[model samples]
Target: MTGSLWRRALAEALGTGLLVTVVVGSGIAAAELSPGDTGLQLLENAFATALGLAVLILMLGPVSGAHFNPVVSAVDCWFGQRHGGGLAVRDLAAYVPAQVLGAIAGAVLANLMFGEQAVSWSTSDRSAGHLWIGETVATAGLILLIFSLARSGRSAAAPAAVGAYIGAAYWFTSSTSFANPAVTIGRAFSDTFAGIAPGSVPGFVVFQVIGAVVGAVLVLVLYPTAGDAADEVVVPHTESGVTS
Candidate 1:
C-alpha cells in the first residue's frame, strides 16, 4: 500500500518469475543429473525448490508481499476488502496478471537454460481423481498455513515454513503439490520433468481454487480474527518499511 502500484506489480512479476525459474530449472537439472532414478530426481528437485522459495520470499517479501500466486492474491483481496485492510481489488488485478506472466517467462527461461524448446507444450497428463484430490489438499494446507501464521503473529516464519511445507508436500502429495495456479500454468509450457500437460491444467487449477475457498472458510471459522492480520500474511511489507 505504501509503494506505487507499478513497483509492487514489478516485484510480484520478478518474484514469481524467479520462483518458476527455480522450479523448472531444478527439475530439468534433476532429470539430467539423476537419469532413471525417480526418487533421486525428486529429492533434488524438492530440495532446490524449497531453498529457492525461502530465499525468494526473504528477498522480495517486502515488495508486493511476494505473493507469486493468484490464489494468495485473491484471498488477500477478499479478506482485505472485507476486513478493511489487505490487497485492494486493483492490486489483485495487477498482481494476478503479473504473477501469471512472470510464471510463463520463468518457464521459458528454464527451458532455454536447459537447452529445451522455448515453447514446447508438455505431454505429461495428470488427470486422475487422486491427483485432483492431492491438489486440493496441498492448496488448502498452504492457505491454512499462510493465514494461520498471520493470525498468530508468526509471519516471520513464513519464509522457511512455506518452503518446508512445499518441499514436504512434493513428496506427500500425489500431484507433487502444484499448489499454485500460476506455477501450474507455467509448468505446462515445458515438457520437462516438472511439466504438466496442457489438458491437465484446468482440473488442477479448479481444484486449487476449491482448496483455497475451503481453506479460507476454515480460517474464518477457526480464527475469527484472522482477517485482521491479512496485511501481514506471507510477510509484512510496505514501501516505508518491512517487518518479518
Candidate 2:
C-alpha cells in the first residue's frame, strides 16, 4: 500500500499481461501439439498455467501483491479498510483498469505470436446456466483460498497454493475455471483455444463478482478477528515498505 501508485499499477499491468499471455499462448500450443486428444490438451494447458501463475506471483507479489484479478484487488481493499492496512480506493481504481487493459494486450500478443489476426473476437460461446454456476464456484473458491491464507498467516504459501487450486479447478469445474475476470475478458480477444466469446463475457463477470461477495462473506464467518491482524510486507516498493 505504500508503493507509488504508478509502480504498483505497472506491476499489476505487466503481471496480468504475462498471465494472460501464458494462458492463451499455452492453450494455442496445446491445441496444436495435441491435435486429437482433448484431455491431453487440457492437461498441458493447465500445467502451463499453474506453473506460470506461481512464478508470476513470486516475481510480482512483492511489487503489487500480484493481484492480477480485479476481484482480488477489490477484496484486498475492503479488507485493508476494515483492518486498517490494505490498498487505497484510488489504488484499486488504477489497478482494475490496468489489469483489464493488460489482459487485452496479452490476448492480442498471444494471437499475434500464434500467427493469428490480432484483436480477433472469439467465437467460443460459453453461455449456459451450468457454466455460470461453475464460474461462481471457481471464483468463490479462489477468493476463499487467498483470504484464508492471509487470515491464517500463511500467505507465503500463496504461490503454490493458488496455482495448485486453479489447476485442480480447471478439471473439477465444468467451465474450465475462468476464475479471474480480467483473464476472462482477455480471452475474449482471442479466437483460439482459450478464448471466450464476447457475448458470454458479461454473465461470467457478473457471476465472478457474485462469487467474490460470497467468498468475502465466508471469510467474515470463518475468520472473525479479535483485533486487526498485522499486515505482512509481501510486496515491497523502493520508497514505501508496505505490501498489499
Candidate 3:
C-alpha cells in the first residue's frame, strides 16, 4: 500500500477514536454529574468534545484530510480527490468501521465512567423535522468552516474551529447539531448520554449530507481554483485544479 494510504488510515482511526472518546466521555460526565438538568449536562460536556475534535483534526487532517466522517469522505470522492467506489464496499475499509467502532467505544467508556445512556434528540425516531433541520444547519457551518481553513492553509487551526462550531451548535441548533452523518448514525447504537435513538439515525444523516452539499457547492462557486484569493484552504487536489 502507498504511504499516503497508510497514513490516511492511521489518521482516520486514531483521530476518530480520540474524537469519539472525548464526545462520549464528556457527555457521560455531564449526565452523571449534572443529572436533572439536560441543558447543564450538554453545556458542561460541550467543551471537551470540541477541544478533542480540534486536536484530532490538527493531528490527522494533513494525513487523511481528517475526514473523520463518511460524509466528508464521500464528498471528497465526489469532487474527485478521494478514490470512489461502491459506498457499501468502500466504507468497510477504514471510514465506516473506524467511525462506528470509535463511537461505540466512546459510548461504552461514557457508560462505564459517567453512566450516560442516551442522547437527547429533537424527537423520537429521528423523524426528519427538527433533527433534519438542526443537522443541516450544523453541517453547513462545519463544512464551510472546513473549506475556509483547508484553502487558507490554516489547516492547523481547523480542529479548533470545528470544535467551537460543534460545541456552540449544541445550544444553537436543535438536535444538538450532530453535523456528521457517521456520528449521528453511530450515536444511535449507544444508550449513553450522547446516544441518539437507533431508529432516528437516518434522518439526521440525510440532513447532514444535504448541508455538506450546500457548503461544498458554495466552495466551488467561490473558489473554482487553488490560488484564488477567495479560497482559504489549499487542499492537495486544488493545487493543480485551478488558481482562482
TM-scores across all candidates? 0.97, 0.93, 0.78
Measured by lDDT, the strongest candidate is 1
Candidate 2: global Cα-lDDT? 0.85
Best by TM-score: 1
Report the C-alpha lDDT of model 3 over 57-124, residue by residue, as the tens digit: 66555555567786666555554442222122343366656765666555555455554444333223
Residue range 1-244, candidate 2, lDDT tens digits:
3447788898889999999999999999999999999999999999999999999988888777888999988887887788786777888899999999999999999999999999989999999999999999999999888877877778788889889999999999989999889999999999988999999999999999999889878878898750143243222223242453
Q: Give all candidates' CA lDDT scores.
A: 0.91, 0.85, 0.64
Error of 3 at 112 (Å): 3.6
Model 1 regions lying over 4 Å from their true place: 1-3, 240-244
Judged by whole-model lDDT over C-alpha atoms, candidate 1 comes out at 0.91
Error of 3 at 228 (Å): 9.4
Off by over 4 Å in 3: 1-4, 81-93, 114-125, 226-244
Clashes of 2: 1
lDDT (10s digit) by residue, model 1, range 4-33? 788888888888989999999999999999
Task: Using TM-score, rank the candidates from best to worst.
Answer: 1, 2, 3
